[model samples]
Structure formats: structure tokens, C-alpha cells
Target: MKYKKLIFSSIGISLFCLVILLFFVLRGNFFKYTDINSMISEPKTNSLIVSGTWELSSITSLSDGSEVKSSEEKLYITENFVYFEKMGTTNPKFKFRQVNFKNYLLYNGVVTDKINIDTDDVIVVSIRDERNFYKEFIVLDKNKIATIYNKKYYIFEKKSDNVDKSIIEELSLDESSINPKKDISFLIGVKSIGTKDVDYETFLIRKNGDEKPTADKVEGLFVNNKNKFFLVNANENEVFVTNDYINNTNKISLGVKNATINFLSKNYISLESYNAETNKKNYSIYKIGELSDESQMSIKDIAGDKGEKAYFNDIRKLGYSSDNINLYDMKNFGVKRNNFSWVFKGILSNYSHDNFVSSEIDLDLIPNVDIFSNKSSKISKLRVKEKVPDVLDYFVSPDESVIVILTADDISMYEIKNQEIATLPIFTTSLKNRREVVTFQWTNAISSELTYTEFMKIKRSN
Candidate 1:
């Protein structure tokens, strides 16, 4: 009888201990906190408030005192795991544990335990391993966040949960901004030629022109007004000039062999050539005139000393500026490309060249639009809309009254004075097609070309 009572008592004690353990686990009290008092007095909630998508805006390195701006990198925080998309890498998730009231521990390939939450909007995380020591202090709000990681500072903005539906709507043109006397037209589309498609013919969507322009194999097109227009034919290595758009009066040969016209402006046009032997780029610029007898001029001759360091590969003439141009310096951002770089670094100093003088401007913030005005001889920075697309192309109007942004499937117009964005209609055959299939070129301040149905007619017959 004594042995039986002892066995029963042992079993009861074991069951009671198991129940206690289960209660603690269910109540989330298994981990004990240190005696250190937390500065924040907010009580712990049942759910995580930091679960959202955060986009990288800017990064500042304390070691070199240099800042890099970006609109691409993103971070996804969830209840179970945290995902990071830094540089060019995709989302890599790590399992996280809420060790304390606001503390967390992340484990993937390694363990990071010193994650401390100072408040609902601030967190300080530290990690030390055999090879590296990582630390970050993060401050976050509803729309924006700033973080300091290992002496490097970073800024991020929260992404919107809802998609923008305004892109499909028609664009409202500002009547006051438009010139009533001048006739504006846009080269909207191109039609494939020949039975087997030997060439492409351009078409125009006129805003005020009496008759549309006609051209063949037009690789590039630039319009100053209804009276002045320029077209390039790379196959013939010739540039055709038209005064009335009905007939080509002059044909000018490109100075370099195998040269292609890359960019065209109102007063100047640029040609690009590649050296097969040396693998270097050679660029030439020509002043547009009614007479075809003008010779090609070096960029250095046209832009003077400023053209020496100017990037001709991605040169863009700001229509709003009478004499100023936007020079894209990609080397500062560690990118080797022929496209425009969104970020730039320079000292705030007065810049004067020829009749133009661009005032100094600072661009240390992200999601900013820097407008270089030739009329004012000043560069102004404006904080525009937030939560824009990752990859986009933007154009400012001639009067600096409006800005247009084009993405893969959408076009949005922003008013400079009000800072309000309105979605513009995309005149394409299909909305499901990717933006890469469409070709868009801005011809003038109020005109552009949006081409679709490229080589589609050939595929349809087969």
C-alpha cells in the first residue's frame, strides 16, 4: 500500500509540472527579461506593428562621408520572418523570435540576438561574429524611416498597400500653360512597311497642326515647331531636314562611318560612333540649320570646357531651360551605363558657362526632383510625390509647370505648383503587354511618340 501511494504521488507531480510548462508556453512567458528598465513605457501588444514594405531612399556612409541615393532597395517585415532586398539581391528571409517585450532574435545562417526595441518607431540591433560586427539603429514612422547601420545611415519610405488606379485616366492639360498660337504635334505611332517589313513609316498625332508630318525609316525625330523638324536614317547614314514636313530639302552625311544619331534637341543634335579596333565611343554634335552645308562640331567646341567632363552618352536637353542641360554623371553612383543616373553629387557653387549660369543646389534627400532652369540660371529641388514606381522615366515641361513620369504600364503627370499627380491615358493596343515592347520618345515640350504593334503584323499572318 505504501509503494502504491508513492507511485501515484510521483505521477501527479509530473502531470502538474507539465501543465505549468504548457501554461507558460501558451502565455508567451518562457523567455525572461533582464532587470534593465526599458526607456519606452508602451505596453506589449499581441501583434506586430512594424509589418510592412519599406523602400530604400538614401544611404550615407560615415567612413567616407558619402551618401548614395536609391529608389529600388526594399525590406519586407512580417510576423514570422524578415526579408531584405539590398543592392541587387532579392528577398532573403530570416526566422525571427520575439525574445523580450520589444526585442527579437533572427536566425538563418547565423544567430543575431542583441535586437533591442527602444520604442514603437525606434530599434537598435547589434550582432558580433568571428568575421564581422553589425549594428543598426532604426527609426520608423508611418511613411518614412531612417536607419543607422554600422556607422552607415539609411533612409526608407513605406510602400503603399493599394495600387494606383489613376494611370488609366485621361490627362488634363493646363490651358494656361499651353501656347495658343503655336501648333503642337506629337509623332504618336509607326507603321511597318513592305510585304516582309523592310522599313517603318512614322505617323503623327497633332494637337494643333493642320497636317501631320510624313517620313520613312525615321530612326529619330525632333521637332522645334510645326515649321522645323529633323529626322535621321541610320541605314543611309543621313539626316533629313524638313521646313514644311511635306518634303525633305537637305540630306546631311554623318561625319563618322557607321554612326548613329542618338539624341536630337532644338538647336543641337548628337551622333554616336563606336571604334571596333579600340572599343571606345566617339561622339559628334551638329548645330541644326536650314542650310545643310554646316560641318560637324566636337562636343568640346560646342559646350566648351563644360563639355570636357560632360557625359554626352546620356545628354538630355531640358526643355524648360533655355540654355541649361541636364548632365548625368553615373560614375558618382558606381554605375557604368549609357543611361541617366538619378543621383548626383557636387558642391554648392555658382556655375557659369557661355550665356548660362546655373546656381548651386543641394540634393541630399531622396524622392526629390531637381529642376535646372536656363532662364533662371538656377537649379531648384522639390520634394514630390512619395511611393512611386521603382523604375521610371521622368520629363519636365518647358515652362517648369508640369512633370511627367512614365513607367511600364502607366503615365502620370504632376503639377509643379500644386504638387498634385494625375494619371494620364496610355494609347496602346493592349494594356497587358509589358512596357519594354512600347517605344516612347519625347519630341517636344507638349509632344511625344508612343509606339506599339511592333512586328505584330508579320506574326499575325503566320
Candidate 2:
């Protein structure tokens, strides 16, 4: 009787547990698991990541089943666009959607539209390429994928670990690299920026209650000490100009053969045309406001050079972003009383793109000197609070709000807030074989548009 009772109790407990499991599964909590591999259906509750950069690993001719040369092209997959670049030419891409983001299908190129991709699982990827043809791809595994384009089976291996890495690389190109003939990545580097017009003349609350605006009458004057108020898009090769940055009816091709914008300042803009095959460069200059071309939004050229500025207290200005950003030691200002900290400042006047936060970190207000006493308030100020690093070199963001400090050991980024350099870094990553890197620039390559009105404002203010 004891044994029978125990058996019955065990059976009842097992039955109750089974029922509880079934109930939870039906209620969806059990199914709402968080395994990245459990990407079984659409609207997955689990967070699944998609690969962004895929290098062409191998190729095979589908018709003959024979080996082929590698094109070295890379597949850069963005949230909405899938680009096949490095074809030894400009990039080409198309819109895409997905099946649990595992399978990709061509879309109508509308960002907000809900795209339903009901295709066979065998077609891991598909694109409606030019000439209205379909390109199909198959997934080999989690790290590899194969696509068939024009009777050729091309296999690609995922390079970047995740999509964000690819996006950052794509977004971080120098503003000068934004050529209309280039891929969508460079094109988006600039076209995505916004513009603003702020009023001046009356002192707005300067941090810690400094000077008010330059005037009393406040109106949306076309110029701010932040960014240029304009827009620039383009066509295939030497696209037409949008002179006013708003109107496009008058189409005149800028004769400047897609030269890289080299120098930008309050008065002049320069373009450098490079002969890649010959390894040569030619420079040209244009006055501000009267600027043309590019999908980039920054104000000027990076003034590319293999040279580094001389040590602390070197007065020879090292021109960077738009010829504005410069790193200076306290010695540079002729303060021989005591050795001191090096500061960086950039002119973000009259062309603040994205945000006006840069105003807080402007050319003046650093070294917190008596504004009335300084012989030169002509330069802005960004003091790095005394904690100097073994900085081999540094790069400033276009807006000059942050700076990338490169040392012998690692690369670190710091936020330039008013009077406070964050004790902690935003990020620090070590680069392998630092000596092997021949050319490394951490800026976007995009062209820009400066309207006549805004240009005039900048020139007059300066």
C-alpha cells in the first residue's frame, strides 16, 4: 500500500508539471526565449544580428562549374541597402528586406514601407539589379554566404563581426570621399546631415553667464557660428549644381572634375584633384558660399599630408578639419611663466551641421583667460585638463566637440565639455601593427553645399 501510494503521488506530480509546462508554452513566455540562434520565425523576440561587411572569398562559374578569379569586391549590407563595392569602380547597390533577417529579398526602396519577403529558403538573398534582373544568393553557414550574379557564383565571407562595425567604417570616411560616382555609403555620409539658422547680436546665456548675442534684435538670420545651411546631392559623374542649396532648376555641371575638397576656411575653399594611376595631386581654390558638389556635410578639406606638426609650442598651425582645428600648447600663446597643458580648438562658426552643441566648445573661452585682456580672441579654446598623454597625433571631429587621441599604445576618445575633460574615455582600442598602416584617416569623404546667403554671412562675420 505504501509503494502504491508513492507511485500515485509521483505520477500526479509529473502530470501537474507537464500541464504547467504546456500552459506556459501556450501563453508565450516559454517561447519568448532569448537565444540568438532561435531565429525560427518573423518578429522574433530574440535579438539576432546580421553581418554587415562580407569580403569576396571565392568564386565559381555556375554554367561550367569551374574556378574563377576573385574580384575582391565586398558586400556591405546596411539596414535597408545591400551594396556590392570594390568592383574596381564606383559601388552599386539595391534595396533589400529579410526573412527573420536570415533570408534577403529585393524591396521597392521605400524605407518605411512594410516589405513582405515570401521567397524560397534556398534563396538566402536576392536583388533586382539594373536591367531589371534578379540576383540570387545562398547561405553556406553563419559566417559565409554565396550569391549568383550574371552566371557566376560568388562566395563572400563575413568580415566585420557585427553590423555596427560595418556601419561605423562606412560612416567614418573623410568628408572629402563623398563622390557622386562612389557607393551609397559615401553619398549618405553627407546627405543625412541637417542645417540650422540661429539669430545673433543679443547675448544668449553663455555658459557661466558670459557675453550675450552680438545684437538685441533676434531673428532667424541665415548664419550661426555652427554650420552652413545648405544641401548637396549629385548625379553619376559631375552632377549638376544646386547653387542655392535649395533650388535645382538651374543645372550647371561643376567643371571641377570631382577633385577632392582639400582646404576650407572662412574665406577660401580648395579642391585637390589626384591622379591615382600617376600618384599626383593638383589643388584649386574657391571662395566660400559659392561652393559646389558633394554628398558630405563638413565645411572644408582635411589638408591631407604625411607630415606631423613640430612639438609643443610650435606656432606653425597644423591645419585639420576645414583649416579650423588646431592643437596648441600653452607655450604657443607666449606664457613662458610655467610649462603647461596642450589645448585643441576648431572654428565651428557659421557652419554647424547636426547640432549646435559645438558652440559650448568654441574657439574662445578656453584657458579661461580674461576675454577682454587677451591680445587674440581670434582663436577658439578647448583646454584638455592638464592630463597630457603621449599623444603621437590627434584627429578632431568636424564639429570639434570630441577628439581622437592616438598614443603609442592605443587610440582613445574624449568628450570636450566645458572645463571638464571626462576622466574616463568613451572608448580605447588597440591597433595591431601600427607601423604597417601607411595611410589612415578617420573622417568621412563627403562633399558639401554652402548657399550664397550663408557664405556671405560667414565672410562678413569673420
Candidate 3:
């Protein structure tokens, strides 16, 4: 009888302890859930917020056979229409048709123009032929009703309204001009000229008569109106253009001792320097070089010293976004800066494509981590409903409010407001590597006329 009583007493104690522990656990989770909900419920000042994970396309296999998809897709958003290009697979003989996203939706596929997409007065660049590389580069400017193509030395413009009247002329190219064509990443726009062998001298031509021989390998060329030119390059380092052009000397030094003087644009440049004492990564930047000497300052040094503890870490990727260019100091745990304890460099706009905002981060920084943002203020990571690895690509809206994350297992769109979660889309894809998810978000201007203006203009192309 005594032994039975002792066992009952011990059991009751254990139960009480277990209940207390469970209560703490539940309380912690409840607080976290509440925090996320509060973050999502905040009001947004921006009109539309869009963001997402960019991924390569996937192949869907039916009982019949397998299909392939190409990865060269871009999103073009204008005041009237949103254009999307989805690349389809080529035939066995190496021929393929670029999948017109709009045509696919028109062919009874489950795709709909968003409520905000104006379709009536809409005109878009059509990829007539996908297999032809040269024609693929041709983007028809709908506003001018013309098709623009790239020639070796000039931009050929052809009116889409009247296809016969195409203006094919050399864009301000002379005997002294040498246009260096780069076929690598088709994201940047400016065409570079001058001595290829030389390190710091390149004749950056923005528009005709807007020619300037800039002496910094890192200073890129921006041509505004006619003669107005802006050089986006590092000015402080050895790479620089003299105040006066070299009138006497015809031949300049073709090579540079500093091999890292590669000018990406007037707003950005890449410099290479080495430190002897601490073996630190040495990079120099001259932001706003065209201005007075007081204005010209070293961007790298400013970003580097922001952290209280200047631990020497390798800067993998760095560039500006919006107004400020940021450099990511990679030291295992993603970007390390003393600025905000966990903040990173802001992304920059892609100068070549007005549609894209250019930003760079080393692949090593925050690899495999999901990045989410609420358009107005908050950006965070999403809790994975399921485990999946390998994200192919990501897409964020121009406003940076909503994000669609596509993985090997599923694709989802998350709505964020301020610093919180508002909604997760009900529609989820079970396919692996589901690519080409359209990213969209809500805006304050929810008028029907503004949303559906382009819808009225859809007509048969005669």
C-alpha cells in the first residue's frame, strides 16, 4: 500500500513538470506567431510591392514523353503592359520557338492578366524567331512603334507600324571610334570604344556628339542628351581621366599596372588593390568623380569603416542600389556590416535595362536562405512549409512588396505589409523547379480604368 502511494506521488510530480514545460514552449511559439502576424498587418505606403525567388525553368513529363524549357526569360513592365518571355525547348535538330507567355495563356492555359495590368493600349516586343540569335536581340519599341536591333557599330531602328521604313545607320561611329562589343551578360547597355589594349582610356559614347574619352578603366560611360556625358567610374584610384584631353600625345599607355580598373558605369566601377600588412582585400572607388575634388570620395573606405570592429573580411560582391551602392563583406555568416547589425548593401538600378535594378551579392552570401520583404519597411525569411533545396531564380516586383518563391518542390507568393506577413497564396504548384511565376502586389490606385486600360486594345494583328 505504501509503495503504490509513492508511485502515484512521483507520477503526479512528473506530470506537473511536463505541463509546465509544454506551457513555456507554447507561449514562445505563440509570441513568435503573433510577431509575424503583426508585421504583416502594417499599412503600406507604396502602391504595389512585388518580390520573389528567381529560378531556372523545369521540364514536365507526361505519359507521352518529356519536355524541356529554356532559362532566358525577362520581365518588361511599362505604364500600359507587362511583357513576359518564357523560353521553350528546341527540337532534335536544334530548333525551338520562344514561348510567348501571352499566347500560351490565350491557348486555354490557366493564366490571367493581373487586375492592374493595362491591356487596352498595350504594345509589346514580340520574339518572332527564337532560334535566330541575331533576331533574338531585336526588341521592338512599342511606343515608337518601331523595332530596335543592334548592329556592330550602331543601333538599327525599324518602325513596327511600317516595317519597311527601318532606319539603319551607324550610330555616330567614325574612323577614330572603335566599339568594343561584349556578348557576355546582356544586362549592361553602353557600348565601349577606344584602345582595348589600354587599361584606363575608353571613349564612352552615350549619344551622338556626347563623346568623351575617359581615362579610368572603371569609369563607365553615360550619354544623356547630345553632348552631355557622365562618367560612372572610380575616380580616386589610379584610374582617372585628366581634366584636359591629351592633345599632344596620340598614343596612350595601352596597359595598366592595376588590372582591376574595369569601369562598369558612371555610378559604379571595379578596382583591385592588395594590402601588404594584413593581407586585406584592397578595392578603391571614386563615386561622383565628375564633380569637384571635395565631392569625389572613396566609397569603399566609407563602407569598410562603418563597422566598429574592422575585421578584415573578403568583400565578394558590391554595388549600389537605388541611391547608394553597397559592398557585401563576406565572412561566413552572409554580409557583415556594423550599420544595422544584420543589414546589407542596398541594390542598384541596372543602367542598361531601365526595367531591371542591378545588384550583386556573392553566391556565398546567404546561400539557400529565403529573403522576404514587406514593401514599405520589413523584409524577412519565410518559414518553410516543406523542405526543399536548390532555388533556380527569384523575381521581385518593382515596388518590392510581394515575393513569389519557387523551389524544386513548390511555388508560392507571400504578401508582406510593413514588417509582417499578410497572405500566402492558396494556389501552390507541386512541380519541381516551377519557373516563370508572375510576381504582383496591391496598390493604392485600385481604379478599374487604371487597371484595365490595355484590355480594350486587344485586336487581331492584321
Model 3 TM-score, 2 decimals: 0.23
lDDT of 3 by residue, 1-462 (tens): 999999999999999999999999998778644553321222223211111112223222222222223223232222222222211111111112222333322332322332112332222223322222111221212221211211111112222222111111121121111111111000111222243332222211111112221111122322121222222222223344322221212221212233344323333333344344533343333333333323323322323342212222223224332232223322212122121122333222244544533333322222111221112222433322232225432323222333444554544444434424445442343432222211112211111122122111211110
lDDT of each: 0.36, 0.35, 0.28
> Among all windows of ten consecutive residues in candidate 3, which has the lowest summed lDDT?
178-187
lDDT tens readout by residue for model 1, 1-462: 999999999999999999999998765533334332333333344334445666787776544544544535565444332334211111222222222323322211112222223443343332222211122324354566555543445676778532222311111121212232133223322212222322223333322322322222233342433233444444434445443233444555444555544444455544444557744444444555632335554333443443334432233222222233333211111101122222222211123563323222222322111111112201122333252444344444443434444444544444344334445322222212222211223232233321212212212322
Candidate 2 lDDT tens digits, 335-421:
110021222223222235743222212121122111111121111333432444455544443333345455546555665554245
Per-model TM-score versus the true fold: 0.33, 0.22, 0.23
Rate residue 448 of model 2 by lDDT.
Answer: 23
What count of clashes does model 1 give? 0
